[model samples]
Target: MKKINLYITLKQGVLDPQGKAVQESLHTLGYTAVKQARVGKYMELIVEDDANVEQQIEEMCTKLLANPVIEDYTYIVEEGIVQ
Candidate 1:
């Protein structure tokens, strides 16, 4: 078995309105000192078989996991021993 971890984040110069909104709300709630904020997604996948999983996962990310125009993604794959 293998474990794949993916991290998706906004590219530089891209505005994260949602993150900004949350930061403002936090300040209003007395959570000041927040210099900046950004939102992103983290995902983990378990590939139980070795059937071109890496290639397929890369393709999936390019197609839908991330937006090439405003976001970037990176992944890590590790071998695991399933019980």
Candidate 2:
């Protein structure tokens, strides 16, 4: 068996209005000095095999997991032993 970890983040040049809103709200709530913030996505998947997993995960990210036009995604695949 195998496990996949996916991380998706906004592209460098993309603006994150949601993150900014959260930061502003935090400041108003007395948690100042928060600086800047960005939102991202994390996902995990359990699969049966490791072969070509990276390619497959990348394709999944491109096709459905992430918005390639505004975000970037990366993943790691690891072997899982099922006893």
Candidate 3:
């Protein structure tokens, strides 16, 4: 089996309203030292062992896991026995 960790975030030059809101909330709560805050999505996927796992993951990301217009995605694959 393999474990895939996917992280999705807004692309550069894209406005992140959620992040801005969190930063403002933090400032209001006295965390003024924070310059900025960015929000992202993290996902874990388990798949059957296959030589083409990486390719499959890339296809999945492009097709459904992330928005190509405004978001960027990266993933790490860990191969080991499934627990």
Top candidate on TM-score is: 3
> For residues 54-78, could you state the per-residue lDDT of candidate 3 as single tens digits?
9999899999999999999999999
**How many residue pairs clash per model?**
0, 0, 0
Q: Write the per-residue lDDT of candidate 2 for residues 23-79, one digit (tens) a residue.
A: 999999988989988989999888877567778887888899999999998887778
Q: How does model 1 score by TM-score?
A: 0.83
Candidate 1's residue-wise lDDT over 2-63, tens digit each? 88899999998899998999899999998899978899999988878687988988898999
The model with the greatest lDDT is: 3
- CA RMSD of all predictions: 1.9, 1.7, 0.9
- Mark the regions of model 1 whose C-alpha exceeds 4 Å error after superposition: 49-52, 81-83
Decreasing TM-score order of the candidates = 3, 2, 1
CA-lDDT, candidates in order: 0.88, 0.87, 0.94
Q: After superposition on all CA atoms, how large is the RMSD of candidate 1?
A: 1.9
What are the runs in model 3 whose C-alpha is more than 4 Å off? none
Regions of model 2 farther than 4 Å from truth: 81-83
Among residues 3 or more apart in sequence or in different chains, the pairs in candidate 2 whose N, CA or C atoms overlap within 3 Å are: none
TM-score of each: 0.83, 0.87, 0.95
Better of 2 and 3 by TM-score: 3
Ranking by lDDT: 3, 1, 2
For model 3, give the 10-residue run with minimal summed lDDT: 74-83
